[model samples]
Structures are given as C-alpha cells and as structure tokens.
Target: MIDINSWPLYVQLAFGLGPFVIGFSGGGILVFTTLRHYDRIVSSFPNSRGVQNVLRIFANYGFHPRSMQVAAIAGIVLFPRMCIRRGELEPEEVRNFPPEIKRLMVIFTTLLGVGLAWVALAVVLLKLSGGN
Candidate 1:
C-alpha cells in the first residue's frame, strides 16, 4: 500500500487524473471509430427499426465517456498478466489498418488531448468562480 499523502502534489494529481485520461482515450477512440464507420456499423445489425434504435442507443452510450476509464482499469489489471503468460507479441505481427482508419486515430488522439486540456481549464475556472 503506497502512501499517497507522502507523495508530491503533482504525483497525487496524476493519480487522480490518470483514470480520467485513460477513460477519455478509450472513449475518444470509440466515438471517433463509431462516427467514422457509422454506415458499416449500422448496416451489420438487423434491419428492423426497433432493433436498430436499440443498437443505436447502445452504440451512443455503451461506450459512453467513462466506459474507457473502466476499460483502462480492466486492461491494466488483465492485459499484463495475459501478456506475461502468453509471451510478447510477435515482431512480424503488424496492424495494417486502412489509411482512413489511421488518419482517424491521429485526429482523435489530437482531439482528445485538446479536449482534456479544455475541460481541465473549464473546471479550474468554474472552481475559481465558485460555481457561479
């Protein structure tokens, strides 16, 4: 059990924000990917409007903003153990995603950083203003 109180302020702040960052990263990818492949994703589901609506709702909120945070925590706990037991990824294995997908990833990463900073600034301003 690490002593958080003994840690520097920056480290304490990072510990607080780390989950937000991870969740945002995951949520950003989910949002960008879903929007980019909206047609293809929707087409794969049933043609019924009712089913489609349900799926749409799920797609919109299933990977909602904080979902990525949960996923990040799960991955932190599960991925490393899986990797150690299964061995590392092969050197020859590579993701040959389409150019558009690559572009979306780059765009989303930039947007996520900007968004996080913006949100942080807004929160600080709100607090400074005493929630007025």
Candidate 2:
C-alpha cells in the first residue's frame, strides 16, 4: 500500500481540518435556519398537531425536542443556498416550498451535513494515524 506519511503536510492538515470546518459551519447554518422556520410556523398555527407529531418523532430519536426544532428551522433556511450552490435546485423552487415541508427539509439537511462532516473527519484522522 502507498504510504500516507509521504504526503505533504498541507494535505494532511486539509484532510484534518476540512471536515470539521464544514461540519461546524454548515451544521450551524442548518440549525439556525430550521429553528427560525419552526418559530414562524408555531406563530402562525399555534395549535398545529402536525408540528407536535413531528416534535414527538424527534424526541423518540433521543433529541431534545426544542433543540431539534431549532436545528430543523436552520436546516430549512440553509437548504436552498446549498441546493443552489450544488445546481440541484433553483431559486424558483425555494419560492414554491410550503412552510411546513421546508421545516422538515431543514431538519433532514442539517442531520445529513453533520453526518457527512463526522465521516470526513474520521477518514482524515485515520489517514493521519497511518492506519491505511
């Protein structure tokens, strides 16, 4: 197998730092957007059973409902920007998203971003450790 130690220090640092940066920054954006969207929904429909059900599901997954709610809102706010950057979505699509579904999307995207960052960090650390 090829020796990772032979690689330059910049490469190693990039491998180490890239994921953490993406995870923390991207995750923060997602969490912020999701919470804002949730607040909007709650304000508009205080008696929304659907919202309660959604929160219940998040709680079942071992998340604090309030924190998850905020993350969900952040994710919603960040997704359009992400999708546009990736060329997977257009500005028009953002305008067409229903408020409730937008909140759900945020939650999904935030979790996905966090998971990706964790995985990237793991790979980088493994490489740095010379584990192959």
Candidate 3:
C-alpha cells in the first residue's frame, strides 16, 4: 500500500477531510429528509416491537434529541434478521417496502460503510507509514 504520509499536504488534507464533509451531508439528508418518512417506515411494519423498545429506552433515559432516529437506523441496519425473526417485520412486508425508502437506506448505509472503511484504511496507512 502507498504511504499516505509521503503524500503532499494537499493530497493528505483531501484524503482526510473529503469524507468528513460528504458523510455529514449524507447524514443531514438522513436526518432531515429520510426521517420525514419515518411514519411511513413505522406504518409499513406496524408490528415492530424491538425497534419500539429501543425508542422507548432512549426516550426514558432522555438521550440525545436524535437518539430515536439513530436507534431506528441501527435497528434497521444492524439487526434486520432479528427484527424479522422476532416478528417485528414479516418477509412479505420487507419485500413490499417502499422503493424510495429502501434506496435511501441503501445510500445511507453505503456512505456510512464506505466512510468507516476509509477511516480505518487511513488509520492503517498512518500506522504503517510511522505517523508524522
């Protein structure tokens, strides 16, 4: 792998800062746009229990204002099969979910995944390069 430390200052700044701006913009879409459709998400899977519990717990604890949003995202992303197995969402329901919502989730997930991988790669590169 190429050593990022050896790269010019501008290249290193772009490599490190580009994803930060992109990630936040994508997250803003999720918070402002995607979250507007949250009722649609709940209505699609009215049997949701686990996700509700997560929301409730966050509420009870008085977590961040967007904690429920984050939890719902986590439920959908992290424990999808568990949600299905627990009857929070049925197979048919999942299959019939709105295409736009799925697209949004896919975009959010892909961005988040790629951002994390990029950061991890940077960490490894810096470690290998014997950090400046």
Candidate 4:
C-alpha cells in the first residue's frame, strides 16, 4: 500500500484540509447567498401577505435543496473575482440575486457535496482494495 505517512507535510496537509476548506468556504457562501435571497424576497414583496406566507413555507420546506445549489455556485465563483470579470456584480454593489436563482444554487450545492463525497469514498475504497 502507498504510505500516506511518508508523504511530505504539505501533501498530508492538502489531503486533510482540502475537502474541509472547500466545504467550509462553499458552505459559508451558500449561507450568505441564502440570506441575501431572503432579504430580496422580503423587500420585494413586503406588501403581499399571501406571497410572503407562500415564500415562508417554501423556504422552510426547501432548505436542503437550496443549500446544495448555493454550495455549487460558491465553488464556481469561489470569490467575487469571477463575478467582477463577468460584470455580474460591481465592486461596490451588493449581491441581490433573484429568488429563483437562489433556489437553484441551493440545490446545486447540496448535489455538489454528494458528488464530492461519492468520489472521495470511491478513491479510498479503491486504494484500500489495492486497485489503481
């Protein structure tokens, strides 16, 4: 078996921290986007009680799916630099993505986590079984 303990400190550190860094960064952005989405929803339809109620129900029921998408988007953007290059957001402007887009991000983020885990598990299993 390949000796992980023999690997350089940096390689070990990368293996240990890479997934977590991605997960934490992606998760943070997911939460941030969700909050911004909520704010937009509240501000955009403050006068509509029915719409607000409906949205509230959806939010409560749809958290997981929404979180997944946000994570995926965070992975893609990683930082605002991509957005700046694409002209999606100005340096001075706050992100106020629409609710629909926010919903999509949540779902994607959740799926991204699942996919990452699956691949990681597969690699570990293959290594353990002496498969290249």
Cα-based lDDT for every prediction: 0.46, 0.55, 0.65, 0.54
Top candidate (TM-score):
3
Count clashing residue pairs in model 3.
0
Which of the two, 2 or 3, has more lDDT?
3
Model 2 Cα lDDT, one tens digit per residue, 67-132 = 576554334345446645655444554565566656555555655676696777667767766786
Writing each residue's lDDT as its tens digit, candidate 4 over 1-132 gives 665667799987776666676666556656666665644534543443433444444454466745543343344333556656665434443245354654545554765585578559647955875667
Off by over 4 Å in 1: 1-3, 47-53, 56-132
Predicted model with the maximum lDDT: 3
What TM-score fits each model?
A: 0.37, 0.49, 0.74, 0.43
Candidate 2 segments whose C-alpha is farther than 4 A from its true place: 43-50, 57-64, 70-132
TM-score of 1: 0.37
lDDT of 2 at 117: 66
TM-score rank order: 3, 2, 4, 1
Stretches of candidate 3 exceeding 4 Å from the true structure: 60-67, 70-79
Model 4 bad stretches (over 4 Å): 39-115, 118-132
RMSD of each: 12.1, 8.4, 3.2, 9.6
Residue pairs with backbone overlap in model 1:
23-68, 23-69
